[model samples]
Target: MTIRSRLLLTAAIGMAQPALAEVTLTRGSSPVPDGEALSTGDLTVQNEHLAFTIAVDSQAPWGVPRGAIVDLAPVTDGEIALDRIAFADFIPNNWSAWPNTGREVEIVTETPEKVVIRITRDFGEADIATTYTLEEGSDRIHLVTEMTNRGDVPLVDQMSGFTLWPDSGYILPVPGLAGVDSGSAEDALSDRVVAYDEDWFIALHAPYFDRVEYASKDLYATHTLAPGETRSFEGWLQVGPSGDLAPVVAAEIARGDIAAGSLAGQIASTSGPVEDSVLVVEKEGVPYIWTLTPDGSYEIDLPAGDYSVYATAAGYSDSAPQQVTVAADGSETLGFEDLKAPGLLDFAVTDSAGEPLDARITITEGQAPLVEFLGRQTFFTELDQVGGVQASIAPGDYVFTVGHGTGFLTEGEEVSVSVASDETQEVDVALELIARPYENDWYASDMHHHADQLEGTTPPEYVARSELAAGLDVIFLSDHDSTANHGALAEIAEMRGVPFIPSAEFSPSWGHFNAYPLSLGEPLEIDTSTATAAEVMAEARRLGADAIQVNHPFIPYGYLASLEAGTVPGGFAPDFDLLEMNGPDDDDAVFARAAQFWTQGQRIFLSAGSDAHDVWNDNTGSARAYVHVPGGVSADGFVANLKAGRAYVTRGPLIEPEIMFGTELRIAPDEERSLSFDLTAVNGLATASLIGPDGEISSQSFDKAPSTATAEFSITATPRTEGEDWVALRVEDTAGKTAYSDPIWINPLGEPDVLSQD
Candidate 1:
């Protein structure tokens, strides 16, 4: 029998529970029954326990075409637990166009007891049909997807699955692993993964697959399909109270008929059982971790396979790997022995003031034990610790490096010391302050940053720590499409005595914008779905945003590109306050675009940001803006100064112009004035140039120059035929670092300037 007939018969026989399933269609602000097709409204399926809302079209706030689950909430408390969820990114042709492609939705089966909605979308050579089902008295939603190869070529490396954006929290749990770091996908142990918080939990279960792949919030499985072949896969989305995973696991095991084998063992050394030991079981290069009990015993259920088992712990050396094999539904016992004792390294880092400094410490030479569960090699000194931090490492000749971020004078000081087993070594290092821009009322700010949002892996605490380690005076939180990390980031920034700005990256189909200095707890009022760029900026202003910045305007899906292509409705709106010089890599194209706007008499200022999403792999403040806030780096003062164009964008060098760019300089026609600039680079200076609307007006090249240099040139204010005339400064360091100053308006007296006309 068909699925609908089976469900209907079940309902007729009274085997189905009460008819608690409800289906609704939402268009604009009105919600109606499921059958109505009023311009592709969003569809919501809800049972007694959970509710799932799917955006039926691209006009939804999540900006995804076709059926994308945008919100999930529990019935008891109607709080959203998901930002958005979708199935995407089929490999071997790298087909990721589902979010931008149009599709059709059909209500295949609809009843009070059960409902199933089918969505179909076609690529050039492939077609996919996905069905979502909700049933009465069920806490989970079921999914079945079929992909057909329509072209003549065979599809290889075929893989696709759900991409999830939990509204908050980054704790991901898999079978045989308690807590897996979301930043890395090396430990995908099972076919199920759960993203949970304190109040709600959401899990993806694909039991047909033996292993799962997770990275940047995407969990999927791999398969292959030949030409004219069709492949079908089944999965489920389970929801539950809190973070309990027992129900999900049990259901997955029963559904998939998983015949998991058991591994039970003890970890011991020469003296006795190693109470603090952790067992690592490796199968196909994927590790399943188990923590031992107080008695040094561990038991884990694993898929039947040949495996290598070992033990590692703090203050102890790793044991040799032992190989074993198990049959299906069988049991095995394995134990490890002869773990060597460890030596301790006690280290302290201090500032020039002789006070304890919170700095990053790295083991540059010797092999450090992978004591950190995530296998991290670097360590940080705690702010609350009194004396210093201690690490138990393997006995060897190790070099320890200590320093702060790029803002500090020294990169780091390395000291080599020989250590013996079961011995303690003490080391201390002092860091000197190189340049204190804050003393001169200039604050370094990376205006764009992210935490554990979509495609981001670092948690809020780590985000704060990374930015602080970068020695930034101002911290800005601008995670994509959400402000959930603002409170946590603010608290950490307060504890660290740094200024914090609450912001969000308003992401839409056209491009992305960073709206900053928003009030805490203010609802994200701007509609990110159908709002045009002009409307988005207007909404940000209406929501009391201090500044709205166009982010990465020249890259793919960037605002400038959209405008140039005329893809954005109401194209070329000059409502934005700042334009971004994104990341550390210099983009000459972006500079040329900004200069073009400046020549067109637009006063859009330039700012810099690293756009770091994963702090574990990327630097936070690699490219930053130094804003001139005379009083301090308060949110209000910083935004005000940034809007006034009192900021310079830099990767490493620092530029101080005699008359800061963005300031109007009044001069008579045919009058000449001397322009001076002070340049400083951690690396030696290479060249400095004075730029104008026509071209480079004056320039100086330096060889073997000190870290600091001065450049002075004379500029004559000639009457412009049209538009406005402006002068800017650009400097490059020997290390290929670059800095650019905002243009200084050389306005002829009795003539209207760009800002004056505006």
Candidate 2:
């Protein structure tokens, strides 16, 4: 039977008596073989609201190929005009869609009210069963997707659910792509995964309150599943006219049908009030975490069922997760009174001038990170705001590594303090600021940063001091689509003698970009998740943005490759100035891609950022852009220098490339017979390579450690058969610290080169 005729039948029956209508499911085989489709076959589901086909092909029965959601629109009119490339499934790792290889599907049950189908692969090693149900007289379908591990190996980084790729012209309620650990109905309600398209509205309801992520045209959920365990997700997809969905969301919340429950608990082992304790609950191999107030009590809004709960603090040993059960909407109060006590360690840092200096610190237990806090803010640990460092740590020997950013170096110190239940210890360290080759004029800046804006977050003033403590001369609070903190941050930067550049991270539907030097008003008139990359760049320029940078292009929705692919409508490879070379982790792929674009004659500049959101956990300016503003550092000077390509990005080692002939820094090809630049580093260096034309043409390695090195090469005046050639340098020190210089154009001899675009 055809799906349209089945939908018409359901609608006719439901018109007589709303609640009397029942869902009907039909099984059929595609043109492809059964093994290629879902093992059992494909299933067609239809109701008044929408009609779609679920394919359980063996290649990956769990994955929904393009056009899975065949139809969706208001219940009255026939299916609205929209893209049919909607898919669903469980992704085990990153953003790449799961192929569901070596998997098969089984039809568990078929009824009017619900249809349950299980998709499994690897000879029953893993299984995910999804039940689709439709209510009479309603424009929504309830989906309950559950995944279980039947194999001996544990399922790592397993994230499951559906992603609907509807047509554009919709708005995401939130700024970013995802939200983690949404606790209350109001909290989840504020960030509804609903998209409004003219007269129609499509929404994804998370009744039980879990981690939900949605783009302009996509919706999905993620969680890990373990061996012999199952992780279930409950939500509803509502499609109807544009109006209030509060009632639908509220009803779902009250139903308490979601997978997890609420866990309320308290911290009991601290000496005083339990300020700043983290509660972690792991259920079915999925962990839900919450940060509680410094007070003695806490609450876990959504606790996965049959989970273990624990508490952890800076210096205290983590309390093992105790197994507990929490019912939906029901609460379970738990406590941690036996958490291992920790010795208090205090720090006092100073500069060579005997003055206090805020220092970036790393406290390691053995060699691993002692504490890595999560929940979307800054993660680097710094002592600038607190004016000192203090920790409550388990009584054990640890190494306290300290260094002032860029200009100073301080060695690590071994600390051993024993405490009997309660005791305090103190330590002191001084970082000596050594003279560098370019400290006189070059200034460092962390161009991308975010502060705690959710609730009870540190003020922007404190964050400003943290930037200063990290030895940053300039800072840009490029919060996600909001400049609410920039005003206060600018004031604080003034007082702290640091230049604050006003900027916002333009989150276009295609990718993320950062626009700088914004004006005070109702924010930029650009909705990144809905607008195209070209439209976003045009809008930024119209709004007087001095520059726009592509941020973290290696991330999930990075625009570089997407634009090249032309997958997103209205998206094109717009000419953007600076490309981000640094993020939370190292991505050589992004760096390599940027180089490929540059070598292909795209006039791209290089920039780096710490991407620091949490000051205490993230190094504010770990990866910084050193801009050479020879005259003085001003707002305009900073931006102009960057646009002019007078900058180099660095993490630890310092690299500067100077194309010199006689006394000139920039030489014309007619005068570029030979050029040389001195590469200097504070650390012992081993090798330096000069990159040009085809690739690394020349390289030098040092037998003995040298504080400085030089690379010289002859520039050819030959006419090239390809695009323009360029030159740059990459240097690495004995400590493995490396830096890449901004590329300098090696123009063809006698060719008239346009130096500036503006």
Candidate 3:
């Protein structure tokens, strides 16, 4: 029998009747009044081991009873012994919110030598019972659970549950299952702060870990259980003292790798040709169809509109959604690409020394060539596999070049190619690289996050790995009110060459603010964290931060407004510089509002932040954030871009709207100044804003750029009291677009002869 089954067996058999004293004082005292079957029937033991006590306070349904305790430091019984437990100190630590924990608890030691622990709130109760038996000269503990409802119906499949051990750090046994659903708290999707959320448990949500949560790369999984009418689960909690127990439990659960479960939904039939076990299709209101079965000519009937279909089997994947406009005939072929779909070629790069680079490479204009492979049209690409390179292409001829940041490849390096869909082709190119004129650089980083562990969530590696993959320039580890994980991430980022800024998301009663360059210690823990909006600005300056940023101001975690009261106990206000105008997957409202607030919060510099704990979905960020250093891309480069106001956020467009000497320049203390744009429409519409043209003080309305019909328009600058000032336009439009020009220094005429011309 499985260990779980065996343990549960003991619980069931012992509770067959409430007779026999049902408990003993092997190590402590109880609340059952010792030999008296008293009132609510709750059992407890206190100071049973060393100086601590274990208590289980049970009460009548919908009510709380008094707790009983027994001090164990005074016990001298050496033969029947056990360690003490602290059930009351249980607190879940994770990124997302879970059920509020309950208080009153009770632990029972039955006469037949069984341990029954029950924790209750006014609404419900959960019971875990274990019996110790002597077998073959060894003592075995059998455990089982029985839960009851104090209200009308069963508790909805909930995210309520808890399990922990002594802080000394022991590996959790495997071959076992979580009492709550085994979904996940964080995964590649939540950026790991929620930690390790995977595709398997689409709806289930209680996360499970084997010793270390990250062991899943080796430990595998199968279908997760859903809560039904009295559904019972079983597993073995193999005992082990140390080391990762993932492989050990995985092998014991199933002999081989066939553990991922099959879906029972209507869409399960469509899952067959999918790769990586993932399917991505965008529809207005309908959900995507998923199939767990292995083969079928799946047909999707849809009402016309724009859509994207991505299918994956194992890890092979394909994507491209279409927006179909039905003709007068009211029909169209929303082609489902099988092996016959347009081919995708993976490209890779590395350093001049031939090291492989993990970066996003874009192919534009359909001007790139195609190659043939396996008797079909295909595109060729490459991946840096252990320092080597390769490519795949559809059968065709065309010229190709690279864009965005430079790697082993340079800009405008054209290549012509042709291939038959039947054969594989091999190609290799070497690169000569150069550094930028500037010595120092700037960086990019996400500065807000929370840490939760009692919930089996918050895998730190996901936070580290996603940024590495997304090409984020840097990251600031700022857990609210603490820097506990700072040392660990710093060491890890160094190995990855990404700067780990010591930061704090300190808040006051007004708003949330971030402090950077704070020496990787406790420089900014707050009484509020998001309380005083102004204080955040002041703190950033006091701490010598290169920049201060405000975190998500629109995420209504049920506190859209009315947080000034303790109703929203945790938030605070803070000081700042830059503001997060954009985050990963920020919607238009979120983006627009952030921009509006930053414009209103004039003294703060504005920037984009992806409060992402996961970067598994960063494909939309191709043009992400790139700063054109008068040098190379690095942490220093990112910071410099922010300080000089040379940074613009985008996924596509590159805009360059500058000021000419005569047409766009004017100088006057009280009168408005005007800056002109020679303007070039490089890719598409570029939106520009005149920033701090008035003494590091932004003129209102600079946040949202009015839709511009032409490529250039003169922003009649709003001038503030100024001596020698700065002015520049920040612009960006739809897909892959952006532009930030150098600031112009406007010198007022009568302010002393300040002209020094050679």
Candidate 2, position 259, lDDT: 44
Error of 3 at 612 (Å): 2.9
Q: State the local distance difference test value for candidate 2.
A: 0.55
| Tens digits of lDDT, candidate 1, 1-758 | 32234334755765544444454333442132221112346677766667676667434433344465656655544333333233222222222212234578898877776788888766447777788888876777888878888889976765565555554544354544443333333444566666654345677776555334333345555667788998877777877754434455445545666655666788888878877576766666544433343467876655566888787666566788888786666778888777767777788877778877666677788755432432345666654562277877766677877766553234567778776678988888787755667777878888888887665667887777667667678888887767778888888778877788898888775678898887774666655655667888887776678888888887545788767756575577778888898944435666776777788988788888888876655677888888888877787888888887888888887777778668887777787788888777777788998888887898998879567788888888888887789988888888788888888888777443233412
* Candidate 3 structure quality by residue, lDDT tens digits, 506-594: 54323445566665654543324222334445656665567666555444221222243222334444334554544334433334443
Rate residue 210 of model 2 by lDDT. 34
lDDT of 3: 0.34
Determine which window of 10 residues in candidate 2 has minimal summed lDDT.
58-67
TM-score result, candidate 2: 0.57
- Candidate 1 whole-model C-alpha lDDT, 0 to 1: 0.67
Q: Write the per-residue lDDT of candidate 2 for residues 1-758, one digit (tens) a residue.
A: 32234435766776776443445565654321111233345665555554445554322111222223333444344332332222333332333322232445566667665555554433135665556665545666677766678878887654345544333223334223323322222333223365443345566655333344433223344455667887776766676543323333333433543444455567766465455665655545443223343576775445234766677665566665688876655667888875556666676767777777665565544322112431111222333343366655555456656655633233333343444446787767766664333365777788877664311134576577667667677867776566778778777667656677888776543466778877742366654434556777887777668888888776555667455535344646565888887653544565566568776777677788876654654567767787877777887788878867777776655654454110113334454465565665556667877776577877878768676667566665445688666666677777766666677666555343323222
Structural RMSD, model 3: 16.1
What ranges in model 3 sit over 4 Å off?
A: 1-357, 360-500, 504-514, 521-548, 558-574, 583-601, 618-646, 655-666, 669-711, 717-758
Each prediction's number of clashing residue pairs: 0, 26, 128
Pairs with backbone N, CA or C atoms under 3 Å apart (clashes), candidate 1: none
Model 3 CA lDDT for position 361: 34
